[model samples]
Target: MGALSVDELVGRDEWDSVVRQHRRPFVVYKFAATLDGRIAAEDGTSQWITSAESRAEVHLLRAGCDATVVGSGTQQADNPNLTVRGNDDPRLDLAIVHNPDRQPLRVVIDSNAKTPADANVCNDAAPTLVVVAEGADASHLNGVVDVLKVKRADRGLDLPAVLTGLHARGVRAVFLEGGPTLAGSFIAQGLVDRVVNYVAPALLGSGKSGLGDAGIRSMSGILRLELVDVARSGADVRLVARTVRSR
Candidate 1:
């Protein structure tokens, strides 16, 4: 074969199977951290953890997904637009010209509806969906973006139900780009199917970890992952792994 296409590399068949089996979108968690596993500095500064090339790769991942998700904490911290960039293919140009909604949907998990109306994620560049807890006051976001109310879990919003709702809306693959707390909850709940991490050479001696409270009580409780791909992007190393099923 000349080279595996993006769909082949992303295992579209496997993703479709997952969607059919679970009635939910196939979830992929993506993040970048320091060599010491810190996602941010002691003061919570996390800009430029990896090189520009690594950041660009993240956009490519977003482009391949049906939706991109982030938690309220990430929205408060990064205020990212969560739109795909760095793709200039003529095919994509034609697609965009034909269909204005070619961009992946931006989903924000905000239990309290705390996302600001002016946040970058709330921009009109792409459609945004804010998942808030039931009975929460989303009046602030009424005109800013669309909102979805879901049952609340102990950690936050009910993830499985949220995924099911997304699936109903035709989201096949979801790219998760939330903070550690949100990521940890997904991992602890066994909802993550794949993880893509970019490890930078720099070290943050004291800072926030890349994963928080995963409920791993002992060595045996640790979630195991099967390393699938490893590559270098500029000075950062990208590691792609799939969650190994429990026996």
Candidate 2:
């Protein structure tokens, strides 16, 4: 309801307490896109969509998180390091979800193995965690990464199980830096606790929609948000909204 200053916008006290209020695993969805709601350029290029100040605020948000999550598509296409480079604090742990066994420690929902060893998330800075259906490669992926095999009825990881596993790891709060499909999954499951939008002024035509093909049709299905604060940094606008429903 009220406007926030630059310091209040990026400070730890504001988010840390709110995030810690969750006794179970809570997910924070952070995204930045064009005014048209496109997260990437026509060529799948999405580098620095928000202003430097907004991006810096993202890092601060990461610091308040226990872990950061993203889909494997983001890792393969964007090759993001996924590290928390804070301006005033430390970094958060990173997690990835992948199916078909393309990445290790990847939260996969399918029975098939498809992730590649050379994937960017298979690096040292942020180890991978594969969440796959039962009967996936149970062979020890120990030194490289950790694997979490779940019992999935359909071709997807059980959402509650995934959250339970994450909670076991002391990840009370999770930040989702997504490519659309993953975002859609979380939203559809009604698992998102907060949404942070760093709106940029630019417009890019025919690029990837934030969550491509994830049907979020009706307005009623949209997640309810309580406007916590709004701030402007240069040409960008930071809108921080917390989900009001409980899971």
Measured over all alpha carbons after superposition, the RMSD of each candidate to the real structure, in angstroms, is 2.7, 6.5
**In candidate 1, where is summed lDDT lowest over 10 consecutive residues?**
1-10
Q: Score residue 64 of candidate 2 by CA lDDT.
A: 56
Clashing pairs in 1: none
lDDT of each: 0.83, 0.63
lDDT of 2 by residue, 1-247 (tens): 2234323433455445544664446677789998989998887788878887777667666555566677657766876666555434223223212211211222322234344555555566555665666777645445555777767734256666777887776666677888777778777777776778888998887788876543468887666778877778557987877677742
TM agreement with the true structure for every prediction? 0.92, 0.76
Best-matching candidate per TM-score: 1
Runs in model 2 deviating more than 4 A are: 1-23, 86-113, 138-142, 153-155, 212-216
Poorest stretch of ten by lDDT in candidate 2 = 95-104
Relative to the unseen true structure, what is the Cα RMSD of model 2? 6.5
lDDT, candidate 1, 14-57, per-residue tens: 78888888888888888899999989999988898999877866
Candidate 1, superposed: residue stretches over 4 Å from native: 1-9, 87-100
